[model samples]
Target: MEFGGMLSLDFYLHQNPDGGALLDWSRRLRIAAGAARGLEYLHKVASPPVIHGCVKPSNILVDVKFCARLCDYGLHFLASQERQGLAGYVDEEYWLNKSGASKECDVFGLGVVLLELLSGRRSDYYQENVINIVQWALPLIKGLKFSELFDTRLAIPFNIEPLVRLARVALACVGNSRPNRPCIAQVATILTNLEMDLY
Candidate 1:
């Protein structure tokens, strides 16, 4: 059960002792795309169609090839009376409505992960006007200020189109309503396309 040549995105993102991000812009794109594909497989392509109740940076393991493998895919099976979720990644609605969490909850969590990836910060990242990453990044993303929003820990690239698109998709995933949220497949498509466009 031990997987080597891989490190959790959480470590690369938050647990670094040097206080900086390990993933570069392109590598971050790869992780985002790969994680989206994994979620897509779980929500849409699996035989029984599993839902990844917990989707966070810690659950995403990145390999040497910069590919992302989603861990803790079905931990909701072990749910207890207490709310089941990570503080930054879990949706309040998921706790209130425990029925599959309607898949949107997973999407929302992935959105938080994307925000973390972009900011090179943990999901609990906060600012004066923002309660979380989603609140802080959405407006900057909308204003086409992605360069301003990116993690300064890594050197920003001149061509940041992929970051712009990826952030927009993340924004859609955290929509206020279930119907407003992008399906897991759509999220994968957007992220994968952005990944391919990176080269």
Candidate 2:
């Protein structure tokens, strides 16, 4: 049950003792792939097919070897009641009581996580005019301005092909309506392929 490290994915993505990210591009890619597979297992392989209501980075724990382990699965009802943690991670439909915390909503959260990994920003991040991570990154990705979409803390990899593909996946997961969002299985396949290409 216990995977290892106490640090959450958010720690490496946003908070670190050194005031900088601990994960580089390759490590982030590994974490993304692992997290995707974890969600995929929950959605497709689990006996009851659990929906991880809370799919943000804090719920994603990172192991010693940088593998991602999803925690706090199927706890969205509690989070939804409290409305404490769910922010930009959840889709617009999640707020409408009738269409709350479905598999598609989980995919939306995973999409936000992917954006966080790529931009090293929080899902709920805000500034003077900018609203959230999805709002900020989607435009850059739509415009094919990938150079501006990456986390400045880490150097952009020479082979940006993988990141571009990842961005497109994120776009599909978040940009589309709930009925149109790609399933977690599809997202996992794309990320797994990207991870394999790295090796």
Candidate 3:
């Protein structure tokens, strides 16, 4: 129930002692894989299953080894508060309906977090030329320009295949249709495979 060396993935993604990305391509893949496995446990292995309403980088905790432990998995049990505007990481359906967030919403949030890991940008903000990280990176990914989609603070990955595969998985999770989205279990398997293939 307790863990040490707890730090948000947001910190590792956006902050560094040397003023660069704390995680490079390999570390990013490792963390992303770990996160997917944890989510798979919640969505499939746990009895009765569970939904992590918040799946952004800020909610993903990392240990010294950068193993990801998703936090706030139980927040859905708390009563809903008075209405506020949508959070940037929330799925569009959840924001529009003011309804309960489901596993699919969590999928959407995870996609955004993956996008952040790749781009070193927050999901909530729109850059001047691009609407958001998803929009900004999708074209770059599709165009096979891995260098452009990667975090500029880090050297471009020597092997870009894993990053490319990971980006495709992220995109599969981000769409508006819940039914069309890949389940967390599938996403987990894909990420885990990508991790194994890296080494």
Best by TM-score: 2
Ordered list by lDDT, greatest first? 2, 1, 3
Per-candidate alpha-carbon RMSD to the true structure = 2.6, 1.7, 2.6
lDDT, candidate 3, 1-199, per-residue tens? 4588888888877665642456877788888999988888988889988888778887889888878999888576473633232265667677566566788888888888888888887774533454777767777777778777777888876677788888888878874478899988889988899888977
Shift of residue 158 alpha carbon in model 2, Å? 1.2
State how far residue 30 of model 1 sits from its true place (Å). 0.4
Please list the C-alpha lDDT of all candidates, in the order they appear.
0.80, 0.86, 0.78
lDDT (10s digit) by residue, model 2, range 1-199: 6864657888877778542456888888898999999999999999999999879999999988888999999877665454557868788888776647999998999999999888887776434565799988999999999989898887888899999999999999999999899999999999999999999
TM-score of 3: 0.88
Q: Candidate 3: which stretches are off by over 4 Å?
A: 17-21, 77-86, 126-130
Considering TM-score, where higher is better, how would the candidates rank from best to worst?
2, 1, 3
* lDDT top scorer: 2
